[model samples]
Target: MGEFDLIARYFTRPVRRAALGVGDDCALLSVTPGMQLAVSSDMLVEGRHFFADVDPAHLGHKALAVNLSDLAACGARPLAFTLALALPRVDAPWLQAFADGLLRLADAHQCELVGGDTTQGPLNLCVTVFGEVPTGQALLRSGARVGDDIYVSGTPGEARLALDALRGRLALPPAALQQLRPRLEQPTPRVALGLALRGVASSAIDVSDGLLGDLGHILKASGVGACVDATVATNLLAASAQQAVATADFGAQTLMQCALAGGDDYELVFTAPPAQQAAVQAAAQASGTRATRIGRVEPAPGLRVVDGQGQPVAQHFASFDHFA
Candidate 1:
């Protein structure tokens, strides 16, 4: 089919008043009057983002979700998006499922799919998401300060573990496999909670390149350092410890490695002043999302992971590298 046929068949649809809806070079949106646009772009490449055989529907969800996660890091509310898709051929079934997944997220988040280009090439998807936050109020990596508490949302490393299972490094029960597949394939973008954090979080970034590496972005941007207690940050592994140990497995350590270095978690990592800690906690509780304090910002200018006795561990940058 042709471009116009594809648009009418899948993308064009009615949207809420906040979004002017499709059919333009750019989408028109009305945000809170004085806010500035908060925009982010992400690209997903086949074989890198997913196996060639992975489900198209999940792939589509992830391409958009990752971009939305970037906007969330800036505490921006969803406005609209543009998608640029490159495919080897126009497989109707694949396009249908992909569009279904994209529309599902757009409708839920109230973002209209405005415009994009389609071309002949290896499979790749790029999405640019638009959002808005009050002027001078967008949460940024540079705003972290000494004495700020570092926090992360939801559990980490599950996606990486899912990858391990996919690669046959470990065996997962059918139920566990089903549970992890969605997380590995399609992650939820924490938009509402992130927008709720505006004015509350001092600095923010999503865990796109694992916790340690992504946190390093905040440290570098803020011109500060951090000391993360791996003990606390690795607590999520405790939940699976029984099963891991019972199976005579190193699953716990694997999970830790994944949490520390695996990209694609897409959960938010943020800092807040100690004084606002209570307020941040209350907000997360109200939203029914778990936000855990995993570390603290320091005046020194290096990233360090310390043991209980405050001794430093050997560290190496172990996250995803786009050009590696």
Candidate 2:
């Protein structure tokens, strides 16, 4: 089938308003009168992002989730998305499952799948999502100031643990394994929480890379520095340590490494000024998401990690790099 025919037949279904839908060079969307568009894009490749044997449905869900996570970081309400998909072959069942998974998340987030193109090529998927924020009010990486509190939503390292399980390096119970499996496949994008954080967060970015690495983006962008409390930062590791002391497979040090350097958690990493701290906490509670104050922004422009005693701790910068 032709490219346009494929999109019409498979990708384009009835969605929300579209002044100009598929079949044109561009789709025209009307934004809320007082809102500005917040746009973000993410791309996933078969080998780099997921194993070749990984479920196509999960891959599709993640392809959209990552982009949606970006909108969350900006505290934007999702509007629509355009997808560019490349595949080696047309597998009917695979396509159906993939679309089902993607649509499920889209419907949940109230994001419309506006338009897209499909082509025969290497297995790759790219999605660009559009969201809306009141003009001049979207959270930005540059808004952070010294003494702002740093926060991260949800837990980290689950996706990396799922990867470990997939590679056979980690042994988990069937139920635990199944639980971890979703981290690799269907990541929960912090959409509602992100929108709730709009007036509270001074700066934000989704943690696609590890916490340290992703936090560095904010530090660099805001022209500031930070010192994370190692004890608090490694809390997950401490818990795992207690569990592993009896089991002996996972170690505190190892878990700490994973929490520090593991990537793809897709949680929101944000900064808020002291004045907004109470509001931030309230918003997170209202959204039913845990927002941990992991660190504090500093005036100096070098990022550092410290123990409870304020001594600097050495950390290896390890996380996902598309090129590396």
Candidate 3:
């Protein structure tokens, strides 16, 4: 099939939230009176981001989901998105499945697909998502303050566990691997949690790059230090991963590395003041997601990991870096 034919057959759709949709040269969006537009872009290349044999449908879901996570970090409600897709060759079945997955998630959040480009090249998907937040209520990395309680939404590091198992670096039972695969392949973007945290969270960021690295962004931006309870953070792994961890004999250090630095977790890592702890929990409940308090912002200027007894743990975990 030709480019335009492929786009029309798979991606064309009516606009619900956008002024102009797929066929147009540009998508037009109107912001609410007191809200500001929030925009983020994410790119996924075949081998770097996903396995060669991954499901096309899951790839579609993930391409957009990662971009949505950025909006979630800013406490924005997803409105619309534009996709720029590149394909090595036209496969009708693959395109159909991909479009189905991408549009399904878009429909769930009322995010419309706007305008984009399709080209002949190695498989790649780039999505630029648009959202909106109250003019001054958008959560930012610079807003965290000393004494703020550091909270993480949902289970972090589960994706990393899935990654290790898939890469053969860790061995796991088939059942355990099956249970953990979704966490890696199809992550749930915590959009509701972000919306609920608008005024409650002092500073917020989605944990895309391992917990420490992403949280480090908030710390550096806010000019504060943090003491993360390693025990508490490590215990946040999902049950399946915990089971896999037990069987792998990967030792405490490897476990800590995955739990603390495993990237690709789209969960939110945010901060709120001690007084807002109740509110934060309320928000978590209201959003139908779990939020755990794992640490506290401190006057010191670097991230420190400590054991449950308040004794420091000597270890370093680095997050994903494209250049490094």
Find the candidate with the highest TM-score and give its number. 3
Which model, 2 or 3, shows the larger TM-score? Answer: 3
| Model 2 spans with C-alpha error above 4 angstroms | 1-5, 237-248
- Model 3 C-alpha lDDT per residue in residues 185-239, reported as the tens digit of each score: 8899999999999999999999888999999999999999999998776876745
lDDT of each: 0.82, 0.82, 0.89
- Which ten contiguous residues of candidate 3 have the minimum total lDDT? 238-247
* Residues 1-324 of candidate 1: C-alpha lDDT, one tens digit per residue: 987787778777776654556676666667678999898988889888899998888888888899899988898888889888888988899999999888888778877787788888999899999898889989999999999999998777778777887889877665666676787799988887788788899999999889999999999999999998776656664454334344435454565687677778889999999999888888688767789998899999988887556887565548777886
TM-score computed on alpha carbons, candidate 2: 0.93
The model with the greater lDDT, 1 or 3, is 3
Instruction: Quote the lDDT for 179 in model 3.
Output: 81
Total backbone clashes of candidate 2, pairs 3 or more residues apart or in separate chains: 0
Clashing residue pairs found in predicted model 3: none
How would you encode candidate 2's per-residue C-alpha lDDT over 106-129 as one tens digit per residue?
888888888777889999999999
